[model samples]
Target: MHDEPLPPGQDGQESPGADQARSGTSLTDDLVALLEDGKTYLEAEAAYQKSRAGFVADKGKWGIVHGLAAFALVHIALIGLVVGVVIALSRFLTIWGATAAVTGVLLLGGYLFARSAIRHFKEAGASFGDDSP
Candidate 1:
């Protein structure tokens, strides 16, 4: 019998991992890398969500800016509806400001929970393994 490294991508068996390995890729490493990427993404998403609360809560220049932006955008869309337009704008500004504030708070909360999200994803990654390999 002769034992030599298969030329580049010539796998003796048709196993999925074997095929990937023959192509100079490691399924195990790929899986780990994917999990790591997911963990990072989730962490970032969660962070964005959690911090949103604080950002919104701070009723400072930002709050007015959001309120004004919403006011302009929402009212501009209703320019044709003359009746109750003023009242609608008033109500919408209040509600939209509140909504933005709440969203900011939620973002902040998500940011805080990002760590847990990463940890959960990491644990999941650690769970995948084959003793035969």
Candidate 2:
């Protein structure tokens, strides 16, 4: 049924040497493709991290505003409590006496709290091998 001879390299089946040469070329192409893929993955990761940091920074501004508002509210509440206590004590003692008593008690309590906080700070620093007095 065959009427003409086929070309040397155009036969139906590839030669063994030709297959080896093609495989060598394919290996190099695969290496280059792998490197390109890795570069793209790294660029994507960097972009994602940058986006996450921007999101946190944007939210951080509101976080600071809310935190300051809460802090101010707490101080206002404490002042109101102090005023209420002074008014209640005025019924038992003179106005000036009640004010002096409350002031002394508050000062003593603040001093004790300050001492306790200092002790705790020292203990925490000691755990990190700090020897500073």
Candidate 3:
């Protein structure tokens, strides 16, 4: 036979089945790749947000501690001032000498109360963190 019809491939006629198969494979691979990329992006973003939130929470904790320290320091300074004034005024006004001592005691008590309040705030803050709105 001089030229019997060559098969589809030999004659260069593209088969529809082959084209459909390749198209299906390509679509599947694209979907898989897109899913992986999305997963990676979400993981990285979650890590960054967590670390950043932790840092911000730590700053809040430090602020609580600083407030406690400041409260104590101010009371200490006030007590010292009152004591010094009382002693100095003793020469001029003997009747008011005890007033300074009472005031000093009250200020010291206030310092202790402030410390308690600060501790409460700190513990509460620690228990309730940035996770909440």
Candidate 4:
């Protein structure tokens, strides 16, 4: 009978795991490598999800901070407008007339600002619409 070289991992030849014999790729080696790669992939996916969640939470906090800052700025501007109108009206009108005119102007300004703020809130998607969260 013609003596042929025995296939790897058979007869006297050591198995793939013996001496870390990785000369040729074997089924056992491939399976082990595949499992290791899968484990690595899952670990990476978990880390990505954790990082994404933190990023979204940070963005929400920043949005809230910015909204509060804008609110304060708008109030400051309104106070300035009130002072300017009062000063300007005192130049021509009597005290009572100026007061009445300023009251009317203040009321109008308040209404306008309220309307504008509501519109802005809606535009910024702060208003709950038909789309449910």
Candidate 5:
């Protein structure tokens, strides 16, 4: 058979392995480089996670502030509603009678809401297989 030169790589460039062999990098050198790269990657990942947690914490603080503000405003609005109901009822009944009626109704509604909350809490606990009181 006629002797022929080996064909060049697809891009007509030396492969990466050829370059590494020419550079005389030993297996130990390659392993050390891999370890360094892994350490750098892990450090970068930790920094990224810390920054993400800080961002979430900042946003969560604002969310809690806004939620509390909304809750306060709603409670204020409910107070106004209670006062308005008391005033309207006073036109047909004595002021004391109107106040008593409103108080009783509010207490009843609160009791019902508390009962529902207790039931839901028990259901949630049961779902987790927690039977303790």
Candidate 6:
């Protein structure tokens, strides 16, 4: 066979048609095996993707739950601190007086913050409008 001239599409290696003609293996068999391998690969990929998505979704749910829990904890702590402050102040003043004092302090803080904000805005505006070199 090596000494003889190679037949059409029969260069040293056997062709698909030659294999089918000489044995039980055929083009259909090869195609079926390829298709089965592709199906298996696709199924594995799909399963992995679904598993990843489920894992991410569970993490997202846990994150939201934990975030909300933390926010509620902080809020409760703030309220507790305010109550504690009022109770401590009540030793020297009436309940209403203590509450008023706290309110006054909060108002003063708010006013100072507002005044500082206004000053910053005015300074920024002046810089923007200044034409001097």
Question: How well does each candidate superpose onto the true structure, as a TM-score?
Answer: 0.29, 0.75, 0.46, 0.49, 0.76, 0.48
RMSD of 6: 8.9
Q: Give stretches of model 3 more than 4 Å off.
A: 1-28, 95-133
In candidate 5, what are the lDDT values of residues 50-73, reduced to their tens digit? 999999999999999999999999
Give the runs in model 4 whose Cα sits over 4 Å from its true position. 1-32, 109-133
lDDT tens string, model 4, 18-67?
65555566779889999999999999999999999999999999999999
lDDT of 6: 0.89
The C-alpha lDDT values of all candidates are 0.73, 0.89, 0.83, 0.86, 0.93, 0.89
Encode model 6's per-residue lDDT on 4-120: one tens digit a residue. 866556456666567577667777988999999999999999999999999999999999999999999999998888788888999999999999998798789999999999999
lDDT of 3: 0.83
Please provide, for model 3 over 9-82, each residue's C-alpha lDDT reduced to its tens digit, 9 standing for 90 to 100.
Answer: 73677776676665676767879999999999999999999999999999999999999999999999988987
Which candidate wins on TM-score? 5
Candidate 2 per-residue lDDT, tens place, 1-133, comes to 9788653575566676786685566767879999999999999999999999999998999999999999999999999998888999999998888899899999999999999999999998879994688
Local lDDT at 132 for model 4? 68
**Residue 21 lDDT (model 6):** 76
If ranked by TM-score, best first, what sequence of candidates would result?
A: 5, 2, 4, 6, 3, 1
